[model samples]
Target chain A: MKLMVSVKRVVDYNVRIQVKPDGSGVVTDGVKMSMNPFDEIAMEEALRIKEAGNAEEIIAVTIGEQKAQEQLRTALAMGADRAIHVEVDEDIQPLTAARVLKALADKEQPGMVLLGKQAIDDDQGQTGQMLAALWDRPQATFASKVDLDGQKAKVTREVDAGLETIEVDLPAVVTTDLRLNEPRYVKLPDIMKAKKKPIDTTSLADLGVEAAPGLKVTNTAPPPERQGGKKVESVDELVSELKNRGLI
Target chain B: MAKVLLIADHDGENLNPTTPKAVACAADFSPEALDVAVFVSGDNGVADQAAKLDGVSRVLRIDNPANEHCLAAMLAPQIVKMAADYTHVLVAGSTFGKDLMARVAALLGVLQVSDIMKVESDYVFQRPIYAGNAITTVEAPSDQVLCGTVRAASYQAAGEGNSASVEDISVDAELPDHTRFVSVETHKSDRPDLQTAPRVVSGGRGVGSGENFDIIYKLADKINAGVGASRAAVDAGYVPNDMQVGQTGKIIAPELYIAVGISGAIQHWAGIKDAGTIVAINKDEEAPIFEVADLGLVADLFDAVPELEQKLG
Candidate 1:
């Protein structure tokens, strides 16, 4: 069996977010960039599957500028055999990215597709499920646990209350959640070997997908800032305030 | 010139809060531009809520026993077929909404825009990226079968007290044959809806012990608020994972958010940034939580807890 994991290069999770002056987008100049948090989990899940002998090949894929290849190599440094680049500029629409992925996925025909539940940058969480639907396949979203058994696959999703396990047929899409597993740092030897790994490059146009404009934004602004609350001197005062407000 | 179809996600019978909230977002996007109709896969009661929400033109009631659970495998195909007749589709990012939205968009050969905070027009949506660090304005190209998932807590339901035209239809859907529901175990908790609650009180590693985690809960109960926790608190077993409010946990946009003993990690702040008011209580005034907090109290949680319990009691 084979596995395809999608990762994105985005603003580092640790950096503070700031909006641009023109407000078209956020400030990225001189800021840190790294692999998406969920994608890291997806890559780690693929690595775990490969280690379990369930996967023969693990190809890391990303859709963005050339810097995305570095993110892909991070996956390779961890354990993937090779990588693929659906090369495109930044600010690519989810549908367009999905179309490019569809083209690559059709050619690769991997038995499984793994992705982070949402990219740390976009947090859309739509690509994997969309891919599954576009290919006429089943999908398990926000998977906390995934286990493959024979022809059937079992997955536990992170629901509102707790884990909700569902079983689907093979050749399905699975998105990773927080509790899935922690990603490991690439060792020195693996990092050295990743430089020699081969990555196939493809274009969005080659995928036969035409970019048609759909949604447009009229305006953008930050959410309302929280107001200040005065502190009560004692719990008795708080309880009285609560009672006056009918909260108690 | 196609109409609209919304997969009414009422968790079987009752209309889930998201269903009405999605209607409000669709209303904001394009009122009367599309014929908004809701399709409930489970209970016909969802048909009952069609009247209460704004912007709904009709309700498609599919009372099928096979539509027992809102499983993605079972509901996606039906939504795909229903989507073919609609120009746009809207679903919330709630548990059932996210799954159905992805499946419906997939069946229609389109990808959905998830957790859209606001929609300005037919073609553009404003969504947060980089874990709420940045916002991106995206334009979806010519695909008319638009699929969107709205954040449940961000919008209000349409004003109640109106009835919608309900129509019952039998769709010879390519019924889902696979994907079995093993069994459901509904773990009950006393916590309010994390996303929609107006007031929230959260804890972190500073709370120190699992047994002591009740401080936040007690504080929340006093104010008719919900309880949340940082990823650290959840990871430390101080609280269940559901209470976690961070990048990967639950995202809450409450009216008032009080952080007790939380140092305010960026990941945790991402989930609560939309909170209307923020109060951070920590011994270390230099904690990151203080940067965004509207009020910072430089006091140990231990001193604050008993004081809170006593005053609020």
Candidate 2:
């Protein structure tokens, strides 16, 4: 069986994102860009599945600018067998991205597709499920644990109330949550080896998909800042302050 | 006038409070434009609960056995079938809502406006991105049906005084047999729910080992508050991941939030930024949590929690 993992290049998790002063977009210039943390987890899970003999090949794919190949190279270093870069210049929304992935899936016919539940940049957790819907395949999202059987995969998902387990057949889509697995650090030797790995570049037209803006962002602004408050000398002072504010 | 259809979120017996809050969000539109729909497997009392929400014109109950487990594949097609009659389809931004709406939007060939914090008009809305660091206002094209999930914490639950008529609708959708429901392990607790609680007491790496969380729980019990843990604590196995409070975790906005030993990271602050009054207690005076805390105390949680519990008692 073959596994396809989707990786996204996003603003690093540590950086404090600033909205553009003109309210046009976020300030990405001069900011550190890294593979989305959750996608790294998904890639780790895919590597483990291969090591466990459940999968024969792991393909890492990304849909973004030329710089996104940096993330695909990182995935290749982390253990993906090959990389596919769907090169696009503009910002693609979730729906259109899913369409591009659907085209790839139709061509590759991988046994399984893995993706991060959401991207940290847009926080849109839609692509995986939308791809599943478009492909008319089963989807197990927010997966914390995955066990592959002969032709079935059991997924444990982190839900609102608690954990829910579900089973889906092969040729399904699985989205990773935070606790799936701690991604392995890319070793120096692995980084050197990744340079030789094949990365195929394709365009939206080649995938037979259109780059359309499904959701329009009319305005962008910073969130309202919370005002700072005073310090209390002691626990008694804290209690009195709570009482004074009628919060107790 | 535009008609809005709200998919109710609930378990077998009781309705999730977020459903009512989503209804409240729908109320932002015309007064008599909202319709609540409950889809359940058996004759669960959920339809009755959906009818009690204020401003609902009617409640549509769709009964089908496949609807029992809240499977997104089974629910999405049914919702898409019903969505053609309404201008907007709304649901809460819970896990169930996010999953179901994404599939529905895909089947309909549209985009889902997720976690909308404010509804500017029937077509325009505001949502947080970059983990709540920035707010983006978006508008759906008028030519297409608007589908989105409401941030339940941003709105109050719709009142229950009004009595709306319940209509039984028959739904027939070809649900795929590839997906099967297994068991669910829900953390059963008697404490107030973390999302809707009036007050929340959260601990961080300062709480130490998993067993040491008892101190935080003891204080929470005294104050009748829900217990929450920072991502560090959850990652350290001090608590379940569901108890984590941060940008990727549960977003909460309680009336009072007491932080114990939490060196506030920006991700954690994003979840609690909407909290009414924040109080931080950490031994380090320079911990970032103090910047937004209404009351800051530079004391060890071990000694401070016990003393504070006694004072509250």
Candidate 3:
């Protein structure tokens, strides 16, 4: 069985994103970029499945500009056997991205697909489920724990109500949540080895998928800023303030 | 005339409060728009509650044992079949909604607008990004069927005076057989739900241990506030992950949010930024939580929490 892990390059989780002056988009120039934190967890899970003898190969796939190859290299260093980069210059929405992945999935014929539950950048959390729909496969999203038993995988999903454990047959899609696993640090030796791995580059035209974004961004702005309040000296002062504001 | 379909979120017994809030968002589009609520579950009682929601024109019930669990694969095809008559499909921005809508959008060959906070027009919407620091307005093409998830926290629930007519619908679409529900482990709490609670009292790692959370709980109990925890607290085994309030956790916009011993990381602040009045109780005055707090008290939570609880009582 083969595992195809989807990774995305996003603004580092620690950086405070600043919207462009003209409200076009967030300022990405000179800012730090890393593989999305959740995608890294997904890659780690794929590597674990491969090590446990459940999967024979791990292929990391990413869709973005040429610079996104950096994230694919990181995924390779994290233990993916190979990499696939779908080069696209413009912004691709979730549905189009899912279509492109579905095309590649058709070609690769992987037994399972893994992805992060949501990207920190767009926060859409749609691609994995959308891809599963396009491929007509089962989807177990927000998975905290995964156990592969023969042709079936038991996934523990983190839902709003609580944890739900579901069993999905093979050839399914799984999205990783935060508690899935701690991603291992990439070693210096592995980084050098990853550079030698093969990365196949393809264009959207090659996949026969058009970049049709269903939603358009009309405007962007900063959220209303909250003003800081004065510090109280004692519990009595706090009580008085609460009373004055009718908060208690 | 626009025809809108709302997918109801519910437990096996009752409907979740977020379902009515999503209906409120759909109602904002047009007063004359035909709003229909779809209850896809094995229980007919869920559909009975859906008929009582205000603003809906009717309730469509698709009762089947396979629809018992909210599996995205099993529900998306059924929804797509029913979606041909509707112009828009909307759901609450809960985990179940997000999961199901994404698949439905894909099957319809359209994109899903997620976590919509404001409905500027029938096609335009405002949504938060970068957690909550930035707001972006999005416009969907008018030609395609628009599908979206409404941010229930940002809207008021629709009134319950309406008695929409109920219609039984049979699903002929073949259900996906790959996914099967095994079991569920839910965190049952007697207090108000954190997302819908008017007031919330959250503890962080500074609260120390799981046992020490009693002080935080006592304060919450006194004010009839829901109990929440920071990701650090959840990671430290102080509380369940469902109680975590942060970017990766549940985003809440309560009337009043009290931060007890919380340092207020950016992720935590993202979830509480929409809160009306933020009160911070931490020994470290320099804690980032004070930056956005409506009232800051620089004191040990161990001392202040008990005193605050007593004073409120």
Q: Pick the candidate with the highest lDDT.
A: 2
Cα miss at B302, model 3 (Å)?
A: 0.9
Tens-digit lDDT string for candidate 1 (B1-313):
3355666666555676666777777777564543444444455566777666667777777666767766877777767666667667877788777766776776676657777777766757777766666666767654567788887667777777667777777777886555766655566767677766888889999999898987778878877888889999999988878888988788887777889999988788889887766878888867888778766677888888767766754
User: After best superposition, candidate 3 residue B43: deviation in angstroms?
Assistant: 4.1
Worst 10 residues of 3 chain B by lDDT: B31-40
In Å, residue A239's CA in model 1 sits off its true spot by: 6.0
Sort all candidates by lDDT, best to worst: 2, 3, 1
Residue-wise C-alpha lDDT for candidate 2, range A1-248, written one tens digit per residue:
88999999999999998899899999999999999999999999999999999999999999999999999999999999999999988889899989999999999999999999999999978999999999999999999999999899999999897999999998999999998998999999999999999999999999899765567898899999787799999999999999999988
Tell me the number of clashing residue pairs for each predicted model. Answer: 18, 0, 0
Off by over 4 Å in 1: A205-248, B1-4, B33-44, B136-143, B176-178
RMSD of each: 2.9, 1.0, 1.3
What TM-score does candidate 2 get on C-alpha atoms?
Answer: 0.99
Question: How accurate locally, in lDDT, is each candidate?
Answer: 0.76, 0.91, 0.90
TM-score, prediction 1 = 0.90
Deviation in angstroms for A133 in model 2?
Answer: 0.5
